[model samples]
Target chain A: MTRRDSFLECEPGVIRLFGAADIGTKGMVSGWSGPEEGHNWNDGVEAACAVAVKPPVTRLMLSVMGEPYVTRARPAQEITLYGNGYRLGFWRLSARAETALLVALEPEWWLERGAKAVMRLMLHMPHSVRPKDINDGQDSRELAFCYRSMCLRPIAG
Target chain B: MAEPALLGDLRERPDGSFDGWCWVPGRPQERLIVDLLVNDTLAISMVAAIFRRDLQTRGYGDGRHGFVLRLPANTEGLDSEALITARERRSGHIFGRVLRAAPAVSAPGGPALDRVERQVDALWQDLDSARPPPEAERPSQRLRSAFGTLAGRLRAQAGRAPWPDGPPIVLPAPVSPALTVAFVARAAEAAFARIAALAPGLALARAELLVIDPGIDPEVALLSSRVRNLRMLRDGAAAGVIAACNLALAHGAGERRLWLGDTVATPSAAALLALARALAKAPPALWLGPEAAISFADVDAPLPPAVSLPARFGMALCVDRAVFAELGPLDPGFGAAHGLAYADLALRARLLGVDLRAVMEPEPPTGAAVEFAPASTAAWALFRSRWGALDPLIAGA
Candidate 1:
């Protein structure tokens, strides 16, 4: 077992870009949805950014579009970020993830599956924050095969 | 197996009496005791006999019991609201509830009937007049001799000038019978489109639509103008809905003013007319539509018809222009800055003794006017500063 404090080395602006989002008019996000169609998950995330992003957010690079949780159980550990010129790596299903993870809806479900990866996020600090213990509906072997190659820093004993 | 029960329809008799059937079938036909209550306080208890009809097609009970009560004349001059409560002799518990608010009348005939009679009398007098003019008078201008009143009308209009600021705000016009529907249009296109579609029905009723568009492009204003009887005002972006609504108030020349929004389902022309008609019957009131209205009592509880005198902000409301001016303009600060503008207006209206009334409809809305919620911390601070304590203001009112 490792000390909780030591396991996390936090920095300012880590969760600055991410925000909590509501269902909001079901796709009435700012000028994003097509004339006929309502907003989908991707558009919801971008539109929610207006209310979600914390202030001094004006200072940071603004991205209407962003990637959130797991995509095919790829671990989504290291994310290539842009605009803000800062790379944001998410630690999904971590012990302290509740405070950071945005709950788009109740009971951990999202408006759209892709929305799970857009609005809810937390910083990935290697082995300190572990992936979800339960099967995330992805092929388990892919997670096993991919995690082996990455230089995953182990938790201190 | 059998307990006391109040069953079936409650009907009223023309002679100011109530006729209804109630009985314990196959039981002893003895002293049938029942009570008739008016306004839930004035109770008139009576001993009745079983109304004989058991031998006919047997209904619920042995159709042997019924009562005809000659309700005392409304000499006390109380509002025609009566509650018919029947308490069984055996149990003494009121079995059912029946609410009736009889219409109040000015005279033997309705206002329209009286007006018609007056016009006919005038016409008869005009027909028998000694002096005959070259041209006949307009029916609308005079009750009798149209030719006699023609010169008077021309002289009146000629003497009167236009509004100092701009053109006269002509609402239902001289001939329009339709009610006027007015709303402040924000950035929502879906809301705007819905109102636009209702224009034809409104025109059918001779109603006019006044749309106030603030800080929007020229196209929105242009689109709204094409509708018949619909006038659009385009104020620059700096003016919020509160300011635009004030502008609409200035130009709204209807018999009564109705405030609505695109967020709500547009009521039918008949329903809108019915609402207007209802207000005409009651005392002058601020008719708050059943959307998001808060109770005068517990702010947390729903604004039930029984307790809530003047409901808080509902999505749509209708007020007379003369009455509205007396209440003063809605505070722009709460609306623009905190988004609590309607609540403030409601409170102020209550303070000024403006009766807040509810227009009943299924699925009442909470009147969340803005597109999004404002930051809570900032909103709360502003609300407290403007409204010192809510409980007392509500309690006092």
Candidate 2:
């Protein structure tokens, strides 16, 4: 197995950033969802990014929102960041991936402007892989087929 | 067929008594023999089981015996009403009824022990199922129930203000000249500010800070080195005020412990000194501020005198180490850090005989009193579902 798979298996609960993440409340608007909507925003981004990339190396990137404000620790394994940047706070790693990842990396100042803000990220994979697992590769084999990707979001306001 | 046996004729003995066997119904084991004699002009029987004072006092008493008529004919149907009536009057109260004669059948051997055993067993079962005797229930049962309720409360309070170690510290008189404080706040910056403002005023040989933060912001991290006595810890919003206080207390050492709110803007340095001094003069297991008013009353003991403070006031409490020796640490089950479970501790201090008293403050500290955030509707709903009958603390007394 690759080092990434071993790392994922050894500490499946740990949340790691693909690239640099800003710690602030303001960012670009990329995706939106209703509180009750069941649609997977990350998958939508993956599909969007998947089709946008060429066949040789199909790639997808997306951001998922997390809990609001700051907490001593994050409670979930798979976290979602919105707007710009990556790395958020950490929490106890669950051997199992979280059912849902919510990101509130932006500060209260930005949150007051709108109900929420979107965290940005990048996703990449080989052309042969499926698009479904692009953002949720750690969770499913289908997404693992996507090959490689990246995501970015801010940590605080 | 053989004739059944009848009551034998009673005969007077040398002690001016009558003695002989009497047949009684409802009892199949053996026929009773009653002996009668004159005692104080009453016809007493020697054949009757004699009841002594010592045996009576010890709860064992024999049945009473008196004169009974005897039947003579062997099996000639001697079931006459007159004879039965005479027997009834003579031993009716003791034996209830007189047995009639029938054709006797000879028994092969002595009565069956198994039959007797079965009968005894049935009797015991009846006794077992019977309602408890009135004497078994006393007024003390209520007292015990109340005490149990109070003990449960003490245990819960002990849980809210849990001691770090196995049990609370056992302190000697004139408590080892020590002080411990659990400081709580939302932002690491806010907590650091409180410590900076508080240290200069609290003149102590040693002081330690257990700071809990939700997120580790750079600003939060900056305060780590600012206070020499500070040890920073992090937890979720759900970890709560009482929980953070307990964690801090676990990491600290002092003869007396206090819960200092981390977010409070102003530090009442004088109030801390006054508290330290008040505890020194009149030592109780737990000390609180007289002005620290709790609007909640105990559901069990409603309107408990307001003079006493609830154990939840750990925010500024000075607990004697000895109290912890008797009761253990604060309970994490109360809720995340500033949950409402702190009030329950006040009830415990009272029930545990730890003497909960409020210190009168001549000059009160200045600052908008920090109160816990209001419980969410969902939180309130869950709390009521879990502890509806138990929660006595409410707003406006």
Candidate 3:
């Protein structure tokens, strides 16, 4: 199996980023596979705050730039990503340890209008901390060893 | 990008102005904007001409700009100490540790301190005239009685005129470091011993141990003399704990001030290092850390930076000197020995847009349990009047 990578650096506190790769094979680079055809997978999309994405990414970490749909999400047994306010129910894509699929606007709604690109793709280092620590408690906001920042490219890239 | 290097001490002048120079190195092509931040608020900004002729002599002509900044006297907010920050204009991220200096004490705001006291005093007079049934009086009415009692005690104990009905005494910071680790000294010399046992050298580096000694023990006095920056203020008259803290605040040179209760053990060297590192982050206006019963930080289950267990008495109640210079001192009128003074201060701080934040300590000291002064209805009345809807935990404490 071929592996690929991308990253971002954050600072004032030991923020450093190194190495870059154009893993854009058919527009699927670093876990962000361009808009896979997804439908409303859960009932009553109204009170739902997140979408359960079955992405190829087992880990994802990035500090968002604007008020993007997914600023931060938790890595659950189902690996839940916060709904980007589009209110589209759970999206169950095939899960993997690498690659991410993130968009600035709501993906499903924007995709219906033929919007095919996300602002950035964030992929974090897999299992950097102990497995026990990830689900340690309720206030699990920090996945300490996750990647810090990422840059965006066109969906067609 | 190369980080900015701020050389020379940023000290407060007698006139209450701050002057300092910083060498900020940037990418030759990028335009850097630098700002002078007082208490995290932007006071001034300048487009950095980030280039130096000396740098050309060294090697490449990258943007290594040298800039000088000066802060004029504050004619308005006579804040005791101003937290000075040299931050990047765009990201608002500071390059290094934040510096603190005393701003010019200006009283443009109607001498709010005096006005508050007068208002409180006037209300007391109204309550006295009305003579409400003693058992049915509200908290504010009860406060009148408390202040009256305080006045009586001042007369009986010191045999002097009662405290003036003006305002709570606001002590201006007299030192340069960021904060002073202050404590009231009585018979408990073990507290000083705990502080002495730590990376003794580390404990006294960035902050000073302010022993507000009413009467010094020979061992503590000896410790003060031996330690480099240990200051034992002469409290011969021996004021109450709140008075000692206010006095310590006046004598403290740091722009920030912290009070330590003798009940808890002192912080270790690692703990001190953790504190300094956290301070480097230039914590928000009113960040606080409490003593942990455990010898180490709760790393296995770490809480967020802002959330922390409550500190009792003085589990290190740190504040920007402005807490006093801005919002008055811990109301000494709140009956001595009923130590809700720190909690009362925290409540007021939150109202002033400064909340007591929890500082995460890696090498937290042992004995987190604090013995609070027995409950005082008078203290509760004072707190409720200022801070509506008391914190249930504190109300019960």
Candidate 4:
């Protein structure tokens, strides 16, 4: 796994797309992908990418933008972007980042090519704190540690 | 103070006319005839061009020579329309108009003057009769009686009551740099998540979520790794939590300190900024925000939508380092877990003669609350106990 990539110098108003070499051979990104798809997964990725470049980004965390709904007899998460910002949550997104770059350029590459095309863009910000000191109370200390781990757990995945 | 000057004498002529010669100060020696009149119809003008021989003898008049006026008897008794108009054009108040129109009457000879005097006297009497007394009528003797009653009640209340003394404990500046968070696992997760969620926009450079991780939980480790500036101190020594928080606080480069909720939802960081700005005014002793149910407790009295008085301290408070120096640290004796520290702090602050205040902020999170029956029960009990003991003193019965 690559250690962690920063948003380095990129073109303005244009998204920087990085896809695996094996990706895009299928010409189709599975599930919900890209801006053209109503899902607008690219916009979500851009939003998260934007947050990593700024100071005070003590944590790189993600939360679904909206509630979930039942689609085709199965429960699917409904996402809305840019509402909190001027064009909806866009301000909320951009204000957190110096700038954002959409990570995915292909829509159906993830499903068609399997593992080769699978690219996960995670926020590469550092954790807010680390255990600086270890003191008394063995059981209670263990309890607190357990609680702290629970706080960082990803609710969806 | 100089005594008031006596009115100048009026000279009477053999023809039953009067020529009054008053010694008015600061006047030129020139004999200037300011008015030439035979009756009520008179024409008056200043004459430098008038060639009078006696006027040339003194020779050095700068043309500011003042002179007397000749008038029909009882100018005070005349219809005062002209005087009233001139006064209205000058001062613009009703009092001025009246004064100018009714100049004081000193000449007492003509029947017309006597009649005008009677009319003025009757009007003055009517005004005086309509006026209320200068002071309201009050029962004077009752004041002493009231004070005596109050003193008796105060003595009764203080008969054997013990109020904490000893220069009230002052909160010391923490010698260490850390914060202690005493909470359960789920509450701990919620607290970290809330802070993390707020971090992106909070603009806060230094904030650490020191979670108590028991069992060396990897989830806790993973969560800790996700956020920058977060430290998990495994030993859940409640005092250690306090000690750790003190450490973070001491080391915290930020200008302000905040004690926020873990599981409890909070307003946006902007909202927190708004609160910090409000507290920056360094208002009275106690500063608080809206949505602090801790202040509400079980009091049915419906606290005013806003009140700035020293009272309970709860979640989400910002205080300067000096306040802690003046006040003191949380009494660790409250317990290993979060409990009565706030009440103890508030009471101690009061004993030290510091006034507390609570101000409301906008857009606090709703529906997310910690239901502490024990806290409310204790708060209500304390209020009643204090009230029962001090009612007579407050009432001055």
Best by DockQ: 3
Residue lDDT tens for model 3, B122-202? 877787678755667566667875765554333323222222333221222222355566777564335445545543424
The A-chain TM-scores of all the candidates are: 0.19, 0.22, 0.22, 0.22
lDDT of 4 by residue, A6-90 (tens): 3222111111122221111122222222222111222222223221121211222222222122223222222233311322221
lDDT of every model, 2 decimals? 0.40, 0.35, 0.41, 0.30
Reference-based TM-score of each model: 0.33, 0.31, 0.34, 0.28
Error (Å) of candidate 2 at residue B173 is: 22
Candidate 4, residues B1-397, lDDT tens digits: the string is 2321211212222232323221112343422222222222222222111222333343423322222222335444343212111011112211100111111233233344335545755655565567643444333224433543443234222231112112221111121222212222223344454545555324432222333434222233333223433333333343433444343333232344555433234545454444444444553443333323233222223333333221222343444445555676765543433333444454456567665433333322233222212444444445445433533421221
Candidate 2 segments exceeding 4 Å error? A1-157, B1-177, B204-207, B236-238, B262-265, B287-318, B324-326, B334-339, B358-397
Instruction: Work out candidate 3's RMSD over C-alphas.
Output: 24.9
For each candidate, what's the DockQ?
Answer: 0.00, 0.00, 0.01, 0.00
Q: Lowest lDDT 10-mer window, candidate 2 chain B?
A: B167-176
Candidate 1: C-alpha lDDT: 0.40
- Output the number of the lDDT-best candidate: 3
Report the lDDT tens digits of candidate 1 across residue range B275-313. 555545555655555432333331333544432322222
Q: Model 4 shows how many backbone clashes?
A: 68
Q: What is the C-alpha local distance difference test score of candidate 4?
A: 0.30
After superposition, candidate 3 runs with Cα above 4 Å error: A1-157, B1-175, B188-192, B198-205, B216-225, B287-314, B337-339, B358-373, B388-397
Q: After superposition, how far is residue B34 of candidate 3 from its true place, in Å?
A: 34
For model 1, the stretches where C-alpha displacement exceeds 4 angstroms are A1-157, B1-178, B186-192, B204-206, B290-293, B298-315, B336-339, B358-376, B390-397
Fraction of the reference Cα-Cα interface contacts (below 8 Å) that each candidate reproduces = 0.00, 0.00, 0.00, 0.00
